[model samples]
Target: MAEPTLEQLREQIDGLDEQLQGLLNKRAELAQKVADVKIATDGDAVFYRPEREAQVLRQVKARNTGPLDAETIARLFREIMSACLALEQRLKVAFLGPEGTFTQQAALKHFGHAVETISLAAIDDVFREVASGAAHYGVVPVENSTEGVINHTLDSFMESPLKICGEVDLRIHHHLMLSEHTQLDKITRIYSHQQTLAQCRKWLDTNMPRVERIAVSSNAQAARRLKDEWNAAAIAGDIAADLYDLKILHRNIEDTPDNTTRFIIIGHEEVPPSGEDKSSLLVRMKNRPGALYHVLKPFKDAGVDLTRVESRPSRSGNWSYVFFIDFEGHRDDENVQAVLAALEREALDVRLLGSYPRAVL
Candidate 1:
C-alpha cells in the first residue's frame, strides 16, 4: 500500500472528529439520564462522588495505551466529568484565598474548573462557609513537603466536624515578580506570605540579599500590595503574577525544585472506600511509660502501612499532645477495623479524621 494523500488524511481526521463529537454528546446524555434517575429516587442527590471519580481516573490511566501520557488523558476525563456534573448542580467550593492563592488552585485542580469557588480570607472562614451550607466543599493546605505541616489546619480539625473526602498535592513554583512601576534595579523591597518567603529563602538570599523582605497574609495579598508599592516586588506563583499583571523577574525561585504542598477536601459527609484509599486518625494517648510505642505497635501487628504522623500540643492542657496520623487502608477494611479496636484499648482517645481517596493527579 502507498502512503495516503493529504486530502485522504484530512478526510479521515474529519470523520474521526465527527465520531468523537457524537460520542461526547452521547456520554453527556447518559450523564443527564443518571441525574434524572437519582433525582427520582432521592429528592436530594449528590452529583459528585470522590470515590467514583478516583476509580474512573485510575481506570482511565490503567487502561490507557496511547501516545498521550496517562496524566494528560485523565485530566481530559476530569474536565468532562466536571462539565457533566455542572449540569446537575454547580458545586460551590470554598478555599483559603483572596483569589489566586495555591489553595484556590488546589480546589480547582481537585473539583475541576466547573465548581463555583468561594475565596474566603482565612482557613477558618473556609470551614465556616462549608459548615454553614454556603459551599459544598472546602480545600485547605494541610502540609508541605518542605515546611512540615500547617498547624492552623490541623488545629481546625480538632474543633470542626468536617471530614476529609479527598486530597490534592500541588507542585509549587515561586516566582519573583514585579509590576511596570517596579524596575529591576530600583526594586527596594520584596513581599510574600511568610511561608512563601521561607520556601524561596535561599534564592532570595543569593539574588536580593539587601532588599527588605516583608511577610503578608497570603501570596495573593503580597501581589496586591505590589500595585501600590512602586518600588516593591512580590514572590508568588503564576496565578498571582497573572492576576496582578506582574512580570516574572525570576521564575521558579524556590529554594527546592520539588517543593509541593498537600491540600485536603473538607465536607460534611464521609466518603466510602475508593479501593486504594488512606485513612487519617487523630490519636491522644494516655500518659504512660510507653505512649508512642502503644500508638504505633497496633499498626505493626495489623500489618498496615503508616504514611505520616505528627504531634501537636493539646489545647486541653499545657503538657498533653495529640497525634495526627495517616495510614494505608480505609476504616471499613477488616485489618483497619482490628487496628482501630486495638487503638481503643491502647489510646486515651482516637478520632478518625476521615478515610479518603489519595491524590491521583
Candidate 2:
C-alpha cells in the first residue's frame, strides 16, 4: 500500500475538522437542554458547579492520550464548558483588582473567559461582593510561595461567611516595564506592590541598587503610574504591562523562578465532595497547656492529612490565638466528620470554612 500523498492528507484533515465542529455543536445544544431541565427543576439553579466541573476535568485529564499534555487538553474543554454555562447563566466574578492583576488572571483561569469579572479595590471588598450576592463568586490571593501568607486575606476569612469552592495556583512572572516616553538610561526609581518588591528583592538589589524603590497598592497600580512618569518603571506581570501599554525592560525579574501564588474561590454556597478534595477550618483553642495538641490529635488519630496549619492572634482577646487548618479530605468524609466533632468538643470555637475540590487545571 502506498503512503497517502500531501493532498490526500489535507483532505482527511479537513474532514476530521468538520466532524469535530459538528460534535462540538451537538454537545453545546445538549448542554442547553441540560440547563433547561435544571431551570425547570429549580428556578435559582447555580449553573457553575465546582464539584461537577472538577470531576469532568479530572476525567478528561485521566483519559487523555495525545500529543498534547493533560493540562492543555483540559483547558480546551474548560472553555467549552464555560461557554455552555454562559448560555445557562453568566457568572459574575469579583477579584481584587483595578484590573490586570494576578487575581483577575486566576479568576479567568478557573472560570474561563465567559465570566463577567468585576474589580474590587481590596480583598475584603471581594469577600463582601460575594457574600452580599452582588457577585456569584470571588477570587482572592491566599498565599505566595515566597511571601508566606497574605495576612489581609486570612483576616478577611475570619469574619466572612463564604466558602472556598475552588483554588488556582498561578506561577508569577514579574517584568520590569516602562512607558514609551520613559528614557531607559534615566530610570532612577522602581514601583510595585510591597509583596512584589520582596519577591524580586535580590534581583533589584543586584541590578538597580541605586534606584529608589516605592511600594504601591498593587502591581497594576504601579503599571498605571508608569504611564505618565519618565523616570520610573513598574515591576508587574504581562497583563498589567499589556493593559498599561508599557514596554518590557526585563522579563521574569522575580528572584525565584518557581514563584507561585495560590488564589481561592469564595462563594456563598457549600460545595459537595469531589472525591479528591480539601477542607479548611478555623479553630480557636482555649488558652491552656496542650490546647494545640487537643485540637490536632483527632486528625492524627483519624489518619487525615493536614496540608496547612497557621496560627493568628485571636481578635477576641490579646493573648488568645486562632488556628487556620487545611487538610486533604472533604467535610462529608467519615474521618473528617470525626475530626470536626473532636475539635468542637475540645476547642473554644470551630468553624468549617469549606470543603472544595483540589485544583485540576
Candidate 3:
C-alpha cells in the first residue's frame, strides 16, 4: 500500500475535525434540552447523573470498534460530561492538602478540570468543608494498598454528617525528586510526608540507609521546600516534580508496584444507583463481649456483604469503639433497612452515610 502524503493526512484530519465538531455541538444542544426538561419537569437540574453516565460509558464500551479501547473512550466521555456539567453548573470540590497531592490529582481526574478545587490542611477540614456547604463535595483518602485504612478519615466520618456520594480509586506512583543543582550521591537528607516515607521504606533503606528522613505535612510541600537547599530529596509524584522544578531521581520508588489509593467523595446529595452501589455507616455498640457480634447478626442473617469494617475509639464513653462499616447495597433496600432497624435496637447509635452508586473510574 502506498503511504499517504503529509498533505493528504492533514486533509483527512481536517474533514474528521469538522465532523467531530458538528457532532459535539449537536450533543451539547441535546444536553441543554435535557437540562431544561429536568428543570421544568423535576423542579431541579442535576448536572451529574451517575446512572446515565454509567449507561453511556457501558454503551460506548459495547459499541467500540476502533483503535481506542474502552478505558480511553470512557475517559473521553468523562471529560464531555464535565464540559456539559460546567455548561450547566460548575461544582466546587475540596481535597486534602496543597496542590500536587495525589488526593487533589484524583479529585481533578474524576471531577474533571472544570471543578474548582480547594486544598484543605486536614482530613477533618475536608469533612467540615462539605458539611458546612463551603464546597459542593469533598475528597479524602479512605484506604491505600500498603498503609491500610486512613483512620483519621474514618473517625471524621463519625463526627460529620456528610454522605459518601461516590468513590475514585487512583494508582499511586511515588518519585524521588531533587532540585537541578542537587547531586544524588551527595544527598544527606530526604523530605516527604510521613505516608510517602512509609510507602518508600524499602527504597530508602537500601539506597540511602544513613540519610536523614524528615516528615512534612505533604509530599508536595516537601518538594516545594527542596528548592531552597541542596543535599536533600523529596518523594512526590509528577505534579510535585513539575511544580517544584525538580528532576525525577527515581520513578515508582514505593515499595510495591500495585500501589493504589481509594478516595471517597463526600456530599449532601444521595447519588442514585448506577447499577452498582455502596453504603457507609457508623455503628456504636455496647462495651461487652457479645455486643459487636449482636450488632452484626442482622447483617449476617440478611445476607448483606460487608466490604469494610474499621473501629475507632468512641469519645462518648470509655472502652467503646465506633465501627465504620461499608457494605454493598442502598440504605433504602428492604434487607439493608431491616438490618439497620434491628441494629438500632441493640446499638448505641447508628448513622447512615447515604447510599450511592459506585464510581465507574
Candidate 4:
C-alpha cells in the first residue's frame, strides 16, 4: 500500500471526528426520547440516574480490556452524562466557601465539572440549601483521616432533613502559600481554618513554633486574605493557591502525608444499596446509665459492624445526649431493619439518616 500524505491523514481524522459528533447528537436525541417517556409516565427527569451510572462505571471498570484506563472511561461517560443531565435538569450544587475551597473541588469531582456550583458561608447553610430545595445537592466535609471527625457536619445532620445520597473522599495536601512579593524570612503569622490549624499542629510545633496562628473560617478564606498582606502566609490547598494566584512556599505541609477528607453528598432522594452500604442514625436516649448500651446492644448481638459512634449534646431536654451511630449495612436489609426496629423502642427519638453505598474511593 502507498504511504498516506500527512494532509490526507489529517483530513481522514477530521472526517471521523465529524461522524463522531453526528453520532453523539443522535445519541442525545435518543436520550431526549427517553426523557419524554419518563416525563409522560410521571417519572423523574434526571437523565443521569446515579444508580445506573454507577453500575455502568462498575461494569466498564470490570470489563477493562483496554488501552484506556477505567478512570479515563468513567471521565468520558461523566461528561456525556453531564450533557444529558443539562438537557434533563440544570444540576445545582452547594459547597462551603467564598470559592476555591476543597468542598467546592469535591462537589465538582462528585457531580462532574458541568454542575452549577454555589458557595455557601457555612456547612449548615449547604445543608439548608439542599433541605429547602434551593439546590439539588450539597457537599460538605464529613470527616478527615487525621482529624477524626467534623462535629459541625455530624451535628448538622441531627437538625437537617437532608439525606446522604453519595460520598467523595478527596486526598488533602495542605501547602504554605504566599504572594510572590512576600518575604521568605519575615513570616510573622500563618493563616488557616481552625480545622486546618489543628490538622497541622505537630508540623507547626516542630517547624515554626513562633509563627502566630490566626484561624479563619476556611482555607480558601485564609488564602483570600493572604493576597493583601506581605508578611502573612496562608496554609491552604493547591486549589486555593491557584485561585488567588499565590506561590506555594511549601507543599504537603500537614503532619500526615496520607491526609484525606471524606465529603458526603446531601439531598432528598434515598439511594439504593450498592451491596456495600453504610447507615447513619441519631438516637436520643433517656438521661440514664446503660441507655446508650441498650441502644447499641442489638447491633452487637446481630454481629453488625459499628463504624462510628459519637455523642452530641441533645437540644431536646435537660441533661440528655443524642448518640450518632454509623454501622455497616443498608436500611433495606432484613437484619439491619430488625436492629433499627429494636433500637426504636428503646430510644426516645430515632432518626434514620439514610443508608448509602460505601464510596469506591
Q: Quick one: best TM-score, which candidate?
A: 2
Residues forming the 10-long window of minimal summed lDDT in candidate 4:
44-53
Query: How far does residue 196 in candidate 3 sit from its true spot (Å)?
Result: 1.1
- What lDDT tens digits, residue by residue, belong to model 4 across residues 1-361? 9999999999999999999899888877887787788899876544445556666667766787779987787777767767766776768999988798999988877777788999999888999898888999989998888878889998898778888887788989889889876887999999999989988888889988999999998899999987678899989987899899999977887888888998988888887877677888889998888887898899988888998888888888888999888899989998898888888888898888888867653
lDDT per residue as tens, model 2, 1-361:
9999999999999999999999989988998999999999998887789999999999999999989999999999999999888888899999999898999989989999999999999898998999999999999999899988888988888888898988999999999999998998998999999999999999999999999999999999999998788999999998898888999989998999999999999998889989999989999998998878987899999999998898999998878899999999999999999999999888889999999999987
- lDDT, candidate 1, 1-361, per-residue tens: 9999999999999999999889988988998999999999989888889999999999999999989999999999999889888888899999999989999889888989988999998889988899999999999999999998999999998888888999999999999998888867888889899989998889888989999999999999999998887789998999898888989978999999999999999998888999999999999887667778888999999999999998898887767788999999999999999999999998778889999999999
- In terms of lDDT, the best-performing candidate is 2
Question: Higher TM-score: candidate 3 or 4?
Answer: 3
Off by over 4 Å in 2: 1-10
Give the whole-model CA lDDT for all candidates, comma-separated.
Answer: 0.91, 0.92, 0.86, 0.84
Could you give the C-alpha RMSD of every candidate to the true structure, in order shown?
Answer: 1.7, 1.6, 2.0, 3.0
| Per-residue lDDT value at 249 in model 1 | 79
Candidate 4 global lDDT: 0.84
Between the candidate structures 1 and 2, which one is better when assessed by lDDT? Answer: 2
* Clash pairs, model 4 backbone: none
Clashes of 3: 0
